[model samples]
Target: MIGMLVTFTPRSGTFDRSTLEKIAGELRGPFDGMPGLRFKTFMVDEDGARARNFYVWEDEEKGRSFFTEELVEKVTGIYGAPPVIEYLDVVGFVDNSAG
Candidate 1:
């Protein structure tokens, strides 16, 4: 399995509530259709300027595909510049429910 974490600053966090709604719509729409995607999670704080994305894919290629040239260009167009990301291998997970 492959894991990815991304942190980026946006061009403007001034999307307003409506713009956020639109983004949400797009996430569930064409954007989610990106290839090689397996799982995704997004984190945005109340500060409204910074965002983080955590992703998982079947392999390194899939994980890398998320940052495709086209995707990067389009994302930069809306969000700004580029995001710094780290690719990691998941070591282990703790489970307590069974205990």
Candidate 2:
């Protein structure tokens, strides 16, 4: 498995908690069934200064394939800045709900 973290600081005065929540809500359904994605989580800082999207994919290739320029542009359009993307090799994970 591979994990990718895309983090960015939003432009000052461009976003608030409510706007962030609304954007996340709108994205939920589409992202829920993305191919090659094991799981994903969208997060924002408590004061709404920063945001991140964490994703676990079936493989590194799959993870890399999704973070395209168009996607980056979309994120930039919303947050007013490009994200800093970081990738990690997922050594392991513990899923409490798995049984």
Candidate 3:
């Protein structure tokens, strides 16, 4: 499995919690059934002025392919900042929902 963390730090006045919530709401459905994606979560750190997305994919190729340069540019326009993306080897996972 592969895990990806994409973090965005918007400019001080460009984003707020409400905006983030709206974005998440609009995107949730499309991502839910995406091929090769196991699960994804949109998260925020209000105090830190950051928004983060965590995604677990079936494989490294799927995870890496999703974060293309064009996607990054598009999101940078929406978030008002470029994201810092990191990929990790998922050494461990637990999904109680599966039960």
Off by over 4 Å in 1: 11-18, 30-36, 93-99
Task: Show the colliding residue pairs in model 3.
Answer: none
How much does candidate 3 score in TM-score? 0.90
**Residues 30-94 of candidate 2: C-alpha lDDT, one tens digit per residue:** 78778889898888877677888899998779898887999989988876779999999999987
Error of 2 at 11 (Å): 2.8
Instruction: Quote the lDDT for 36 in model 3.
Output: 91
Local accuracy of candidate 1 as per-residue lDDT tens digits, 8-85? 676655334455456556776653755656667666656767666687776778677668878777766655547777
Weakest 10 consecutive residues of candidate 2 by summed lDDT: 10-19
Return the TM-score for each candidate structure.
0.66, 0.87, 0.90
Worst 10 residues of 1 by lDDT: 12-21
Clashes of each: 1, 0, 0
Please tell me which predicted candidate would have the highest lDDT against the true structure. Answer: 3
TM-score of 2: 0.87
Rank ordering of all candidates by lDDT, starting from the highest: 3, 2, 1
lDDT of 3 by residue, 13-95 (tens): 54578888988898789797899999999998857478999999997898999988999998898788999999999999999
Off by over 4 Å in 2: 13-15
